[model samples]
Target: MAAPVYQAPPMPTDAEIARDVRREKRGRIGGRGALYLAATAFALFAALPFAWMLLTVFKQNSDLYDPNLNPFLYNDPPTLQNIGYLFAQTEYATFIRNTLLVAVLVVVITLLAAVPAAYSLTRLAGRWGESLGIAIFLVYLVPPTLLFIPLSRVVADLGLRNSVWSLVVVYPSFTIPFCTWLLMGFFKSIPWDIEEQAMIDGYSRIGAIWRTVLPISIPGLLTVVVFSFALTMHEFVYALAFVTSSAQKTVSIGVTTELIRGDVYFWQSLMAAAALVAIPIALLYNAFLDRFIAGFTMGAVKG
Candidate 1:
């Protein structure tokens, strides 16, 4: 017992603790650096097509057509001729106008129909809401290719064929169902308490929805707008089937139909058209990206 010495165990010095902390800090910094590097790389990869389109927009025909020259660089002096041709030679402006008109109309129609339907399904339909919501979403999953033939017949019956109004009428069929389903998911995520509180405070159900619910669901509404607009803009099968006139065509149809002759491809003008349209849309999506993502993430859940 006497030989069992009472020796204190060694404790870490402040320097040692400081060194360990520095090592952990370095590890975290290294991880973040790797993450940043990967993000930048992916961003560059995603941006490659736009960059190529931008370069092609300014490239001369010689520069673009020469197979031997690098596609990413200019061999000849850069010119605005492609953009000039896109504006001056074709019905590009008309296409842009028609596209905007159809997209705006479709967005309006989708919001009007989807919001009320979604609200009713979420708040009033009770347990049957989920089943009905899925049924509505299934309607959206029906491929446009399958539906276009019948839709074409409908367009003919309605005297909307060969008209932009045809697209305005047709685009909402899909947009509304999909948007309603999406909005149902979003609405279900909202608490009943807030709505009940509003009602208790003398707001009608409609008034509560208009004032409290909708203002909180801006992300969902914007998501619907973006989806509806983008769908209208990029819808080619319906546009081609229902509309044929160059003046009535949207950008997706007009640029290809007008720019490409039987064999000849207007590469520069095509790229220019794509660039001008894609860039602005890309900017818009980026602007609302957080909200857009939040909406979709919440909407993927079944209501």
Candidate 2:
């Protein structure tokens, strides 16, 4: 019998391969376009409330209360009356100053405590570091509501009651744990060999951390600072519980306590204060957004 004829499978032509590549490229482009559209929609959705608040800031009292006009649109030309009112009529300036001072203090305290604690847990603790990091994080997960009562008592006992200093003291209880956890992840992601080399070159562990590790960990530090600042600025329950005086109140408490009276609401001035307070934070976040995301994501995954 004749040997069966052997045949090779036909090879894909270059034209066919090119067509397949083109189809795949189109599919990827379409998918990316859809993703962009979806993201844009979500951003708009998230921004709407802020936009409304901003618009309210510029609206006159009449325009603000007008039922016939669109709530989201200005019926009349914008006015600065609400903005002027916020600065002129109320102790808004004091609130802003108090909030700023408290926020700065909290950020400073958090960084001071968290950075060292994080470095110790991640670099010095060896095998126990990871467990310690998680344990610290778990503390952060404990509801502030549960702690506020005891914390209020502690603040009173410590003579911190009704002072911005009270917030400065208590804010760290929450911020430090999260900041330390965040920094621990960031610290773990740093290669140990760099520190070892620094030690070999006559630097102590702390020196290496200061000169080598810290310089490289600016992003992580910024993340902590921003987080701590935002927390202090917006924290309400503790601020409300600890402080009753308008002069000592942070913006969050001040705006609510001062602007809203039972059934009456200073909607325009309230929104104006909200917008003004948010602007600095929004700017800071936007400025460091890339670094924040990088530090947070890398630290989270590696840790």
Please report, in order, the local distance difference test score of every candidate based on alpha carbons.
0.92, 0.91
Best by lDDT: 1
The 10-residue segment with the lowest total lDDT in model 1: 294-303
- Per-residue C-alpha lDDT of model 2 across residues 68-116, encoded as one tens digit per residue: 8898888889998988888888789999999999999899999999999
| Structural similarity to truth (TM-score) of each candidate | 0.90, 0.92
Q: In candidate 2, what residue range of length 10 has the lowest lDDT sum?
A: 294-303
List the RMSD of every prediction in angstroms: 4.0, 3.1
Per-residue alpha-carbon lDDT of model 1 for 1-303, expressed as tens digits? 468888897998999999999999999999999999999999999988888888888998887878999877788999999999999999999999999999999999999999999999999999998899889999999999999989989999999989999998899999999999999988888899999999999999999998888999999999999999888888889988888988899999999999999999998999999988888888999999999999998898645
Clash pairs, candidate 1, are: none
Predicted candidate 1, C-alpha RMSD? 4.0
> Residue 177 error for model 1, in Å?
1.4
